[model samples]
Target: MTEAEKFTEYTIPRKDTVYCVEFCGTETSSQLLAVGSNSKVSIYLCKFREEEEVEEFEYEQLHDLQNGCRVTALSWSPETSITCLPRNIRLAAGGSDHRIQIFHSDLRGNDSVMVLEGHTDFVNSLTFDPETGDRLASVGDDKWCRIWDKDGNQELTFPLSAQGMSVCWHREEPVKVMVAQKNGVIKIFSLSGQMQLMSFDTNQVPLMEADWCVGNKGLLIGAVAGSDWVMFDVSVSSRPVERRQIHVEGTRYFRWAKCHDSLVASVGRPGRQIKVFNAKSSQTPITLSQTVTYGLSWHQKLPALATGGDQKVHIYMFDSL
Candidate 1:
């Protein structure tokens, strides 16, 4: 397998672990990188310049959220174009305090905003709809998947049999959402009917994360405990189309690349290895880093990747495989 070239790494000092990292905004608009750590979330604006030699990120601190609880999940609103008004560059973060804090910043970098309260347990995941950016889907240890409108009003709630770990919205269909649960079940819900459409069990292991492929409609990837991953095509069959045991220890996080359809990155705990795999092939993966990686976020517009773990974040740029 071809290895990715390391670009740069940032060592952010934190008292606790960085649980999540996300790229806020879009490539053409105001872009910021949000890092979620224990009890705090930090935002950094990555300035890019096009030199003859290369393009690099110059990080500048934008804002800090001292939530007094662990920041677990983060989501950025999609960029919109209304030339007369200022861009509503907003970020939503779920904390261990059982609250979802929404932070809004303008082009001038003002980040003071609002907070939404509803969940009773640790909020695990938060994602905004790509189409309208008006609706948000959030899941938590409370075993409830909630949908909120632009005003932060609870539009609907679906109760699950077990605690929810991650939630994501379909890129093309705004009304569809998939939630990964602690009981190894991935449930798909329709916002129009507020009802469950279907569910799949991935080895009956706790499914920690799930991501819908950006290029394929029915393709879904899930990371389970014991370092196992399963790819499911909901439109074709209930069974998994591909399954692989990447890590012998355990895997808590995995994400599909934003631009590449066949590229997927996974982090294995107790092993502290980051691997990039070509999903279309079962060959040996290219090991990006040996350091433990807790969270990963791919640049929305570029072919770059950022990973957070062990009090540091590493950025890498890979050649086309």
Candidate 2:
């Protein structure tokens, strides 16, 4: 690895296998992130201090809530766009108990929790509408995609062709959402009419993940299936316009940079190694060959990445990945 590929990692003090991690994408919540390990999920406020001598990253534990079960997925509400001490924020977490927990915190220790129960099996993924933040979408082993309002009421439930793996909303068109299945089928749903807008297949079995390109305003689709990552231009074709092998062992997930059209990241098995690539040039300049990793995410604005393995949540800043 070159010097630039060597990541400057800042570790959180928590010690446990981090199963899921998500950086808050809401406006003022840029300094916030959630780390789920064991049976608890903790939110932290990060601060960077620069001095003439050195620079450091400081962390403040805001809310540590009991999950009642292992957390499978996490999503931050878009309404958490304020920076204040007495701040009220919402976070939606899917748990192994097959329930959706909406944690309403006010920067205080207490939590007003609302549990949305419908999934008859493990909840694999959960996401909040980035535009309105008033709706939550989830996919699960039950082979169903459930949509709920922030108030915990079920608004819609659609049957998936197979076990749901991942789901995310289009950043540009909030009413449109994408759902990926373990059977390799990817579908875009229009919530306005509760209808299918588009559908395609990876051709490779067991699709692992799918994410909308927020940096590209959701015009592009990115997914990894059977160790191969593919990109689709929704306006152009039903099949991937670009495809490349990212991991030989198997890809666990693929995430697009929140603010860059060219940057992408993924974690795969055998060693749980993480790699960052440029989608435009088909180049992977930086790769982290870690032993074990469960979660990976990017900063809302910067090229920074936060990943969990061992016991800590480590953050990597590109600064000038």
Which candidate number maximizes lDDT? 2
In the predicted model 1, the residue pairs found to clash are 39-69, 39-70
Query: Mind giving the per-residue lDDT tens digits that candidate 2 earns over 48-101?
Result: 543113357777887788898889999998888547766877888889888889
TM-score of every model versus the real structure: 0.88, 0.94
How many angstroms is residue 274 displaced in model 2 relative to the true structure, after the best TM-score fit? 0.6
RMSD to truth, every model: 2.9, 2.1
The deviation in Å at residue 6 for candidate 2 is 5.1
Candidate 1: regions farther than 4 A off: 1-17, 25-27, 47-56, 80-87, 107-110
- CA-lDDT, candidates in order: 0.75, 0.83
Model 1 lDDT, full chain set: 0.75
The superposed Cα distance between candidate 2 and the true structure at residue 33, in angstroms, equals 0.6
- On the 0 to 100 scale, the lDDT of residue 75 in model 2 is 91
Candidate 2 local lDDT, residue 303: 71
